[model samples]
Target: MLALTLSLALGTPAQAQDADVHEPSPAERARPDDSVAGSEKLLLTAGVSELEGAAGGGLTPWAVIGGYGTRDQIGASAFYTRVNVPDYHLDGAGALIGFLDRIEFSVAQQRFDTEAVGAALGLGRGFTFRQNIIGLKVKLAGDAVLEQDSWLPQLSVGAQFKKNDRGAVLEAIGAKDDHGIDFYASATKLYLAQSILANVTLRFTRANQIGILGFGGDRNDNYTAQLEGSLAWLLSRNLAIGAEYRMKPDNLGIAGEDDWFDAFIAWAPGKHVSLTLAYADLGNIVIKDRQRGLYASVQIGF
Candidate 1:
């Protein structure tokens, strides 16, 4: 009888212990649901809605705002770009300020340094020229992401007014002109986002960069149409690699047409800073040909 009683008591405790083992702890029950909620918030805050580059091509084209203030009604940004080649070097600094998320106004200054490596180009230490660029861009169409499902592209119309400071340069090069304003219009489209990306741009501008020493050529007071294209792939979250090609006109009589291409890599550590490095092949300018070199730029914005 004692043994039977002891067995019943032991079985009763064993059943109670099993029931406790199946019950979940309060901490464990709350963790998975909390983790899911946190992940959703992160996705909403950091979507693929940031602007990638400042320009449509080598020139800054109108692009939407990017990063933390991407959703804000107003934003501002600044950039410094340097291009070095065998015959020419250029440095440009600029700023862009946006208003009401619909319009952007920008100004930039460029310093051009040329080398005397070509035919009869004797003008004492080459020539130093300056260019002031003022631009205005207005959005005309759909949103960048909201209209993703539709066929319409986020459209913007932009104009660049360029002033050349060629007083000293023209006198040294035996040219009559001192300074002039060049106007241009640009149309840009961004297609296929995320992993694979493509951008197509067309610009019409009247400039004399092709005419070396300010000598008259096909580039003077003539509107020329150019096409620029880029294809990119996202390797990871903070890095992208791409290739670009530009088709430009041949306005200089001393050389063949100017056709160039570049391969580049860009890195964005955070929302406020980005850096790009590239290798470019500049076909020819003036009598000097096959000018190839490095290009780099850094951009900071808030």
Candidate 2:
């Protein structure tokens, strides 16, 4: 997410000076104020929940904190996402709560429907794989917005614990574990003058199919490093266009697991409502090739 919120904050010092020179207007006093001091009001650049329940793009997490909360208050957000690809469909829902812009807690539930492949494997058509995720994030470094002129970027560390319900199925398919954790470190930078935002994340994981097909197989049993990145352009206060790329490890030799990419557009109609639409390419999944799809998500926050 970009730090567009800084633009609003740049006026605070001036506003304070004006207050010393003249009496406040009735309208200014009558208007509703929902944010805390030291924190800007909701910025579209704060971003929405990611697939794994982190604040970021559709496929990867960014360093920005989530929700509308500031440094002195609590904020929360909920989201639902859907992706339809050839021979498969994925649905996810989650919620996140952030505290004082320093810590975040999240939970997510995902269901993957193996439309036709389920039948081919003799597991009835439309068989579904389910997973539950619990995540936590901690802010670790420089602010992406406040220190934009510097070479440093905002940094954070996070972890996601995943548990897949299809243990037997995964074991039968060569998976050695059904539950595991993924750890990641993310950095985000925003150049307000150029209206550009960029983020990079490094993750360590042993999961295949992002844990839907379980973790660590006989073919590969150790966690490995992977990279994910995003670049976005803030076209306006309410609109942003971006692209994301996430690399995956080919752990299970049963089939090739490839990288993922997406082009997306996000719109924030208000501080409490957001929507995102994207075109995604999930390379390959099991027997399916070129798993392209349409991705959509809706989010509400306070």
Candidate 3:
């Protein structure tokens, strides 16, 4: 769970301040009540960035497009995040641009620090695995923010193209491939009356460690179906509490990878900036068992 915000797309930074003190921009104030394609006077973090660079939760991508623009406008944002486990560290950064509230394009870079495990594996004391990801998403149907009374949810389809830097090391560890593309479809629903947001995503992937450890392994070279989901409660206009569960594949035969989950709290003190804190259970990584620790992220966008 490592995705994170941008508040520079819709209005001035002052407008993003605490929800209680937030001032509506002219565009937002003039928006029609029936607007469903774009956000209207919503908190900047209403659509959190997903790990793969799409809009949603920390692990699962949702249906909503990224950025702060309305249907008639274009919005964009950039983010950086860090996850610290007992024996490992992960750092990621990315930028996303949304068009007409219908399409999204993004690029992300991830670095996986092996720490002591790198020495154990004879790769040095602080060996790292790096990967670059390019992603695209299209809004397929429905509206997550609007149609609250309807049973239908917003839906989208996305793809992530990942390339790892350590091809030789990956192959040495039984990885069948060092790169691959992942496909996924997601649905998200916002229940304003109930102050809850829920999402579910199904993915077809062959990546190990979400592609940080390379794409496929000798043990399983084919793509497998995986699921990710999130449930959140809006405590206030700019505050939310949530839990996420993401299923992962055990492709490498050397060390087993377990599913991931987290309990998180997100706060947007202003429309331009937001922060998220979480306790994540990453199961096991390499030689370390039960890799659990703090996850933190900060974003500034429009």
Candidate 4:
């Protein structure tokens, strides 16, 4: 009688505890609503902001959407970048918002300081060229993070609309228009097991000096195809090193444009902030050739 009572007591508690437990359905587990406030994404997967305010490397856009947002969350981020060359300086600031990890909208402004070269060209000594950029990106197919078992990479298509303030100077220098648009498609693959990331972008544009000197010129006024590529190695969850190559259009005869290259290091202490520094070779800008410089950028947000 004592053993029977003891067993009943233990079995009653166990049965009550099992009845109190809840198991989530497969559908509920697949898309959890707890991913709000832009949380739950892996570090360095969204990438840093490029010059045009898109989520990408230092100079080119990537396939991933901006921020740490998942499928059911909204994310926001902002960034500032400065590039110092021997004869010039470029300052860029921008912000972006991601919706449901599928679409991104961004806005950016750029100021290019001419320094002594401006006076030599009959412009003011401290003359500056200002440009504004608005960008949009939409994910087309695949998932760089979730679909690791598949060979299909994440793909996105983006566009940038640019407007330059120096219309008179641009016209005098043979630029065809003061405002233009650029379109590109990017593919990105993240090899999680190998700690590697690779991206390739195909761009169609006519911008000169990336719109600092306006769009198109006497040399070439039509949109042409260009290529941009990046490769990165993740040293840890928070740190990555990468290199980028961007081919540019040589539209202006008065000033020959050259391809751009950069080796960069990006660090993300957390999901909310990141820092990137690089040695950039701009090749040629206006009268200056081999315009090597230091590039630094900071990004912050959810």
Candidate 5:
């Protein structure tokens, strides 16, 4: 009986050894992990840094164009804009730099043309007014993207410190002789994975731009709430069609200027380029119809 049991154990060992020799190794059986091992580092590095600045209307709050800096570094961008109205026109140019993916600094200058309206106000030919704006933004919490989950939204908070050039022309129109720093705070959120991409933003700002030359009565430093939103439908691999709505304040004491809004269609041909075309109804700016004939902007980034 002992010899029989020993023979069985010896036979089982030899058979097991033969099977092991034909089996695959653990490493050979494992599957590749795409997120951790196969991802392209440069592709992941791209973010807001690749987007151009806002387009069309000035009253509408566009998304923060370039937050492409890394988690602990900085990134920068520059842009130019033009707004042409039936009775007036404006040209603006600006630059922005972001730091540590948490803070941003920006400066912008705008030239406002008063056209024939300037003559009525006792000013010479079309008066050119300039505005210098500085701003800072802090990201509160939330990641713009997370491959593992689909339930969360990206969120951020920001403020702008604007200084109107308040040139001699602006002063002549009753604006404050001294420069003013208008303050504003905003909260923005983006909802991902929806068929119609959407972003909702809310802001409260204090300023007198709504009131020509900041001359309107009841236009003290008071915070006014505003809401802006956008929705886009992907038309193809590189094209998207969208619309935006902005609700503004009626702080201007003058009779013509008051509450207003803008409607627009934007196009993004690729990661590095975008453009927008729109029509704006600026309400009334001083007894004159202030509807902008057309508005356009081109944005390029890297």
Candidate 6:
């Protein structure tokens, strides 16, 4: 989905030498089980930084907070991601901090390269669109991790403020604005006994191409509701397999947009680092069709 590609790494480690082993800190050595909130959560429960910098699956933000910190501690992480398709490429990087396992703050920037398609649109070859995003999230209720016996899932609400740099170019393509805000609420449940994690998010947005093509459009200038969902299977403590689907709006009359989908593998060899790889179908972008390719990301932090 043009999203997180949250977790899976070909399932198992074929060779231990391929991954660098994380050296434990002195405190962890002295008290393994009581190491603190930084490593207290189950491995991989602190979701990866998503495309937009929120914690969750690759393509969509889940209800889970961004880190392993509990009520009295803090946790943070940084991430880099790249998506390569036939006619375009997207690169993003961000960092997030979680406070008291209840609130999250993040910042990210994205670059979308049109490649040869830029020339077709008379925008020059390799034209690129750059955008910046700031996000905040607050947990509303429940706990996806510790409340396994409860039927309720974790609930959270978030907002993203995005600004695009190429205002003139974006308006030339029928975009109504160069900036917009997105609001979303997510619900997530972790079924440890079943080894499954599921999430659903409802988003209110007006951005086009996640804001690379700018915000709103001539077709519909107001925000619209969209849906995002993720399902993951825990194959092991460090491995997970999942799929994601995210609905998008067809705002630009000239370029018909399609929904996005992906299948991903994520692996976390240690608590400090994780990697994700996915096959993503991005449907069509401005002047290109069938924008399908690889999605890869790396995250590092406590």
Among these predicted structures, which one has the highest TM-score? 4
Q: Look at candidate 1 and tell me the lDDT of residue 166.
A: 69
Cα lDDT over the full model 4? 0.93
TM-score of each: 0.70, 0.87, 0.86, 0.90, 0.69, 0.88
Off by over 4 Å in 2: 1-40
Candidate 3 lDDT score relative to the true structure: 0.83
Stretches of candidate 5 above 4 Å error? 1-59, 62-67, 70-73, 147-152, 167-178, 182-189, 210-212, 219-221
Tens-digit lDDT track of model 2 for 190-221: 88889998999999999897888899987898
Candidate 1 on 1-302: residue-level lDDT in tens? 57555756677656555654667789767743322112111111111211112344343343442222333345556778787898888777887766655666777777777756522566556566777777676767765445547666556666666666765655444443444333333333334455654555565654445222333343343556777666666676667777777666554444455766888777767656667777888777656688888878776664
Candidate 4 residue lDDT tens string, 1-302: 56556756677657655655688898867954675676667888899999989999999999999988888888889999999999999999999998889999999999999999999899988699999999999999999988999999999999999999999999999999999999999999999999999999999999998899999999999999999999999999999999999999999989899999999999999999999999999999999998999999999978
Where model 1 places Cα greater than 4 Å from the true spot, the runs are: 1-68, 116-120, 167-194, 210-220, 255-257
lDDT of each: 0.55, 0.87, 0.83, 0.93, 0.51, 0.89
lDDT, candidate 6, 109-135, per-residue tens: 999998988898898999899999999
| lDDT comparison, 2 vs 5, better candidate | 2
- Candidate 5 backbone overlaps, count: 3
Candidate 3 regions exceeding 4 Å error are 1-41, 44-46
Query: Judged by lDDT, which candidate is best?
Result: 4
Off by over 4 Å in 4: 1-35
Q: How far is 198's C-alpha from truth in model 3 (Å)?
A: 0.0
Question: Where's the lowest-lDDT run of ten residues in candidate 3?
Answer: 1-10
